[model samples]
Target chain A: MMDGSMALPFWLDALIALLLLGGALVALLGSIGLARMPDFYMRLHGPTKASTLGVGATLLGSMIWFGVGHEGLSVQEILITVFLFATAPVSAHMMARAALHRRVACRERTHGEPWDEMDRLPGYAESSSSSDSQR
Target chain B: MTATVLPIALALFSLSLLLNLYRLLRGPDIIDRILGLDTLNVNAIAVIVLGGIYMDSSLIFEAALLIALMGFVGTVAMTKYLVRGDVIE
Candidate 1:
């Protein structure tokens, strides 16, 4: 299965290689930041941004590689790209809202709480019912 | 060069998955774990696409697309449940 794909020119191959390497490394860095960040809010920052850009770059490379081939521009991967860009922020927002609703612990340096923001949410209710606290 | 880099890229992505696993396992709170899971879903798409390229097959991208849709829905559902104590209300 590995053999028989058409050959790519030198510069194109190099570009694809660069994209793959850089994307992979950025993804790893983001996951590392996700694991090591001090607060749950802080932890949310890295992976959301990293995974989108990292995967976007990698998919761009894939698109270019397959686009130049015999099938003439494989258009399907763009669906994944658009889907990711559209959803990353939505999920990040949802997860952030979840954190605030639950009043997840934050480090001392975390500035003002979004307690007001949480309170203003349409269905916001205090975490009094959530008795399980790691806080 | 493409040949050399593909396996290295694959290895790097695998390592990234491991780090996401660490956060998923050890997060101090539920949101962090959910974040880990969300990030894990996003990164897994990249891995599948890369594998598709290496295998010279385009069939697996359907799986990647399925993953993207489900991941978003799952994240939203869990977060909604967390906030409102219900998924559908």
Candidate 2:
């Protein structure tokens, strides 16, 4: 079994510890925000922004730990990291769109017109109007 | 020292998982629930990775990879359904 003797150097171990701690802390905070935030959109901000970074840091720490301890470099953890980073924003955007389509209420302090009006703004295509009405 | 730290980190991650579970249960809207589930998926992946570290196994890394793939697909599919009122049309 692997033990402290098999661990990386002092500084490297410290860095790994810091990464794990920081990642978990950020992820915990994101989950806390999801639980505590006032509205759906506000809650959406937490996991998408913070948790992505948290998972990335944790994966980095894992890569470093395994790379140093094993015979060769470790690259598999990078797949999860890249997959998460690429997909997080996309999922967040889809969730926000879904929330808007469902007419989920936003906090009163939130400014500007609802998404329906902004649909006319540059990128949303005219064809989406049919789907908008279906909601 | 490194051996000791792993369990502490694991406990902290478990706490986060509980927090996510609370959000998932308490959601007043479907989208909110979906968001909670998505966050839960990500946190679960993190937990699995930490588990791999603790056990010093490469096998768990593949589990993490699978979770990442399946979770993203599930979230996207659910969101698409919500937006279009149909999964495939």
Candidate 3:
């Protein structure tokens, strides 16, 4: 395992190191944001944006590292990247919808009127009355 | 030289995972916890890939792929349940 390092040139090693470190740090920052953000809506932004990019970078690094040494391109790594890029936003949207339907409280600093006619939307019938009671 | 950098990457990823766990445990709302869980799975995939690199094996990549698939489905199901108050409907 260790002997593979000799096969890779120093600059390639540096590129991999940079990609791995950068991705990990961004991911750590996203998790930090998730932990630190005060409200659910604010917290949603963190992992959705930073973590997606983090994993994408890390996967790219893996692809490059494996591709250079292997017989051809690392197609599996590409599949993960594509899958993540497609799903991350969709999950974030669903989570946000769930939060809204549940009437999760938002921070005062949040500027938008998220509640305006929100209950009229599908799957939110029960929440409209509850929203009125909570106000 | 390449071997020396693997540990640092692993440590950073571990720290991120710990932060995600804290969010999962300390959530003031269910959505927050769900968000934590979603992030956790993504980070886990990254960690698995890094492990593959460290171990010099293509086999671990299969595990990473499976995780990515299952994690997305799980997140979507959980979020749908939260939104509609039911999974299938």
Task: Pick the DockQ winner.
Answer: 2
Compute each candidate's TM-score over C-alphas: 0.89, 0.91, 0.89
- Model 1, DockQ value? 0.62
After the best TM-score superposition of candidate 1, give how far the Cα of residue B9 lies from its true spot, in angstroms: 0.7
Ranking, lDDT, top scorer first: 3, 1, 2
Worst 10 residues of 3 chain A by lDDT: A126-135
List iRMS (one decimal) for every candidate: 3.1, 1.6, 2.9
Stretches > 4 Å off in candidate 3? A117-135
Task: Report the lDDT tens digits of candidate 1 across residue range A69-99.
Answer: 7345555688888999999999998898788
Q: List the residue pairs that clash in candidate 2.
A: none
Model 2 agreement with the true structure over A23-126: per-residue lDDT tens digits: 98888888888889999988998999888888888888888888885533446688888899999999999999888777798888888746666576676646
Q: Which 10 consecutive positions of candidate 2 chain A have the poorest summed lDDT? A: A67-76
TM of chain B vs. native, candidate 1: 0.97
- For model 1 chain A, where is the 10-residue window of minimal lDDT? A126-135
The lDDT of each candidate is: 0.84, 0.83, 0.85
Complex DockQ per candidate: 0.62, 0.71, 0.64
| Poorest stretch of ten by lDDT in candidate 2 chain B | B1-10
